[model samples]
Target: MAYSERLAERIRKALTHLPIKEKKMFGSLAFMVNGKMCLTAGPERMMCRIDPDLHEREVKRHGCNTVIMGGREYKGYIHIQEENLKSEKDFDHWVRLALEFNEKLTSS
Candidate 1:
């Protein structure tokens, strides 16, 4: 399935002030900040790269689900249904979480 171009555009707008790049990964259009993947606008949902420590609480949020890939669960990545992104505020909230986490990452 193809990723959502519209959603990708919105994400682009939100991250415009940062040094970010767009790439195709996980069958989705991912937004990378400082060479790290911060978020992705997938075919049917938005993938948020948050703090792994918050996974248990975040997964309980509306339209959020555990991101399982290759039959394995990715602790820090969670999927947000399209329905949850109808509002720009909601969309930005997820983006903020992702950016916040990305900021905390140590430079390699």
Candidate 2:
């Protein structure tokens, strides 16, 4: 599935004045900071990177889940369903988390 251009625009707007690079990954458009992935807007969901310790708390919310693939889980990386990001406030929740975690997430 192709990433959502509209969602990308919203992310750009939300993160204005910051150095954000867009890249292709996981069949979506990922926004990166300092060479580390911060957020991804896919066709069906937004992949958000945050503090691993907060994963359990976040996944309890509606439309949120751990990042699981091939039976492996990537802590702190979550899939937030599209329905949860319909509002600007909802989107900001993730934007803020991504920004905070970007500082802690090591760049590769």
Candidate 3:
């Protein structure tokens, strides 16, 4: 298994309690909750989910780049750096965002 696979597995284990599913996408794995992408990992170094309404702000705040695929920038999704995942608190922050988005999306 590649590093990404290991990383994905770790993330999967961490999020097992959440109502989410993992799928292969962009040569990596994407975590979806309620049919919307909440997290992604692969060639990209990080994983994060952004609010579509505040994507730009979030991106700038994190100093991260937008995920662009097939000539389109995937709004509301930000790539997280592996270095940022060193701490459980940091990882949990992103997870919280994903969960919040999932809950908001499902409630509507």
Candidate 4:
């Protein structure tokens, strides 16, 4: 599968109250809120577009990694392994963080 349907379902449930739009991008299923990128579910993993200020601290978390493309690190973006999302708390953390950042973007 290009992306994790299971993970996508989980994300869908989490954001059920919000108006979310899904699209296939970067070989993943991207969740967009307020017309901005929020999260993406890929093969056995997910990516979050969070606040750049939290990048350093968040990358230190278990199974969390800064997103890198072509050897360049993308701050405020991270890939989270599915293993770390086994618990609802962990999963909610990422979803909340991504939404918070997305909200900030829309507000500004």
Candidate 5:
């Protein structure tokens, strides 16, 4: 399944307040804010960068599972289900978390 263009557009609009840059990466679209990768949308999946310090908290809060690719679990990233993204509020929350993590890494 391919990523929905509508979903991507909605995400981009919601993130207008942030200074973010979009690029093609890993055959998908990546949103980088402040030079750190924040969010990604690929065929059938949407993921967000997780802050190492708050990984556990975020997982628990959002029920997000680690992103598994190529037979390994990629830490510091979570795959968000499409169903959860249907609501604007839900999508914003995920984007906000990604932005927060990106900010922390770039500032530190």
Candidate 6:
């Protein structure tokens, strides 16, 4: 699966100050921060790693869906539709959420 360069660029700009590494993962472009998976840009969407405690609430938001694999739902990981990221605020929200979780992983 090919990823989106536009979205990838946006993410690149967002994490400009962070020690971020880009890698091909899950058939997408993944942003690894602090040596942990932070976010991923798919063709027309993104996967974000957030706080598991907030999963129930966050997934209820527009264009947000819990990441599921092998019939198991990954609470902290979410798939965000591209339509919901048309605005800067929404884009930033997802990026920040992923970064916050990455920070926690780094601290522990």
lDDT string, candidate 1, 1-108, tens digits:
999988888889899899888899868999989988899999979999999998899899899999998899999999999989999888888888898899999454
Candidate 4 segments exceeding 4 Å error: none
Instruction: Report the C-alpha lDDT of model 5 over 1-108, residue by residue, as the tens digit.
Output: 556576678768878988888888776788888877888886656788977776766666544688778989777788877677777788888888787788778886
lDDT of 5: 0.77
For each of the candidates, the C-alpha root-mean-square deviation to the true structure, in angstroms, is 1.3, 2.0, 2.4, 0.9, 2.2, 0.9
Q: What is the lDDT of residue 79 in candidate 1?
A: 97
The order of the candidates by TM-score, greatest first, is 4, 6, 1, 2, 5, 3
lDDT of each: 0.90, 0.87, 0.73, 0.94, 0.77, 0.91
lDDT, candidate 1, equals 0.90
Give candidate 3 regions above 4 Å deviation.
1-3, 61-63
Of candidates 6 and 5, the better by TM-score? 6
Model 4 lowest lDDT segment of ten? 1-10
Candidates, ranked, lDDT:
4, 6, 1, 2, 5, 3
Model 5 poorest 10 in a row by lDDT:
54-63
Residue 4, candidate 1: Cα error in Å is 0.5
lDDT (10s digit) by residue, model 3, range 1-107: 22376568768877898778888865778888788877777763656776778777767744377878788988888877766666788777777877787778878
Model 3 vs. true fold: TM: 0.79
Model 5 TM-score is: 0.81
Of candidates 4 and 2, the better by lDDT: 4
Candidate 6 residue spans exceeding 4 A from truth: none
Model 1 misplaced stretches (Cα beyond 4 Å): none
| Candidate 6 lDDT, 36-79, residue by residue in tens | 99999998999999999989989999998998889998989999
**Candidate 6, residue 75: CA error in Å?**
0.8
Cα lDDT tens digits for candidate 4, 14-102: 98999999999878999999999899999999999999999999999999999999999999999999999999999999999999999
Q: What TM-score, computed on C-alpha atoms, does each candidate reach? A: 0.93, 0.91, 0.79, 0.96, 0.81, 0.95
